[model samples]
Structure formats: C-alpha cells, structure tokens
Target: KRTSLSMGEIMTIDVFVERYKDMESILNDVLEGTGANKKSSNKEQELNSRISGLQKIVSDLEKEKEMIKRVDEARLT
Candidate 1:
C-alpha cells in the first residue's frame, strides 16, 4: 500500500513536470515567433489560441499540484 501510494505520487509529479515543460516550450515558441514564417496570419492565430489553451491547462495543473501537496501534508499529520 505504501509503495503504491509513493508510486502514484511519483507519477503525478512526472506528469506535472511534463506538462510544465510543454507549456514552457509553447510559450517560448509563441514569444520567439519560432516556425511562424512558414505559415500565414491564420496559422499564427491558431498557435496563439493553442498557447492560451495550454496556459489554462498549466494553471489548472498548478492548482492540482498544490491540492495534492496539501492532501499529503494532511495525511502526514
């Protein structure tokens, strides 16, 4: 039981890190205009839209991580 719980925590942290990295990459691309030259304004808009969506996902993940931390603290206590 303890091992499974620890594994679950590790998995959650890994996923959170992955999503955070993805968000950072997307943000960098949007800010640096990387790969924007090949596409038109519409493509740029699409990229912007995707960035916005990813930002929201990242925000939610942060909230979830905080919640998990709190839960773990409560369990420890």
Candidate 2:
C-alpha cells in the first residue's frame, strides 16, 4: 500500500504541465503527418472521376465519327 506523503513529497505543478505539453506536440505531429495520405486519396478520386467523364465523351464522339464515315462512304459508292 502506498502511504500519503507530507508536504515535502508533493510533485510540482510544472511536471504535469510538461507532460501535457509533450502530449500536445505528439498530437500535432500525428495530425500533420497522417493527413497527407487522405488528401492524396481525395485528389486521386477527383481525377479518376474526371477521367471517366472524359472517356464517356470520347466514346460518344467515336460513335458519331463512325456514323459519319459510313454515310460518306455510301455517298461515294
């Protein structure tokens, strides 16, 4: 069992404060360092969506070109 200490055995307030300071620094580092991967993932998703839209547009344009080529060939023959 731990015995209660007299006034001389008490810890200073600065010790607890320093511990909290260390915790705050660690939290800041974790937040800053870990956040970049999430940002990169979001950017990648945005680019992929844009590329999918462009692909659909390209497909439609290709179909139109094929129809135009068929009509032009028929006229020439």
Candidate 3:
C-alpha cells in the first residue's frame, strides 16, 4: 500500500504551480503591452474585463483540482 503521496502527485502539483506562474507572467506582459497606449483606455477596460473572466475560470479550476487531490490523498490513507 502507498504510505504517502506519490512522487508523481508531488510533481503534478509542482507542474501546475509552474504553469500557473508562467501563465500569469504572460498575461501581465500582454496587459503591459496594451497599457503602453494610454489613449486606448477603453480598449484596456475591455481587455481587463475579459482577462478577469479568464482568471476567474482558471482559479475555479485550480480550486477544484486541489480539492480532488485532497480527497484522493485521504482515500489513499
């Protein structure tokens, strides 16, 4: 029987965190690139709105993934 969370599980969490950070960095760059044009504040507003929606979805998925992982680990115990 498994005594603890497997190496694969640990690695998967690490990978998720790394990818999340990478995505955040990419999103920040996109916002910065557009923000350089101050006259397009309206465009920025629309972009921010869309980005927020995407961010919310990502965060929700992450939360669900974490909850599932926790439940799996509990079952393993």
Candidate 4:
C-alpha cells in the first residue's frame, strides 16, 4: 500500500512538472506579444493575471513535490 501510494505521488509530481512547463511556455508567448499593439492592453492584463496565478500554482506544486521527496526518503530509512 505504501509503495503504491509513493509511486502515485511520484507520478503526480511528474505531471505537475509537465504542466508547469506548458504554462511557462504560454506565459512566455504572451509576454513576447506584449509590444504588438496597444489596443489589446486589457487582454494582456488578463493574460498576465492568469500567468501569475499559474506561476503560484507551479510554485506550490514544486514545494509539494519536494516535501513528498523528503517523506519518501525518510521512509527508506
């Protein structure tokens, strides 16, 4: 049971990392288009807000992944 749970957690960490990378790519694309025009400033603002939220989620997931790693290591001992 413990081994399966640990494996599941490890899988979750991989998924989270993949999602973070995707979100980061999207954020970078949005940022790159910032100077294209002035009319879509509002849209840019909305995208920025969403990107910030995703950033926070990614950060939290990373911390969770680290915590899980520590727990897994402790279990090995």
| Model 4, span 1-77: residue lDDT tens | 35324677778777987887798788769766883766458777787778788888878878777787787788889
Q: List ranges where model 4 is wrong by over 4 Å.
A: 1-5
Candidate 2's C-alpha runs over 4 A off are 1-40
Model 1 clash number: 0
Arranged by lDDT with the best first, the candidates are 4, 3, 1, 2
Predictions: Cα RMSD each: 4.6, 33.4, 5.0, 3.0
Instruction: Report, for every candidate in turn, its global Cα lDDT versus the true structure.
Output: 0.68, 0.51, 0.70, 0.76
Error (Å) of candidate 2 at residue 34 is 15
lDDT string, candidate 2, 1-77, tens digits:
43333333323323444454555455455555655667646655555555455455555545555565576567669
Candidate 4 positional error at 42, Å: 1.2
lDDT of 3: 0.70
Off by over 4 Å in 3: 1-27
Which 10-residue span in candidate 1 carries the lowest summed lDDT?
A: 1-10
Candidate 4: pairs in clash? none
In candidate 1, stretches whose alpha carbon ends up further than 4 angstroms from where it belongs are 1-10, 16-20, 23-40
Error of 1 at 27 (Å): 6.7
- CA error at residue 13 for candidate 1, angstroms: 4.9
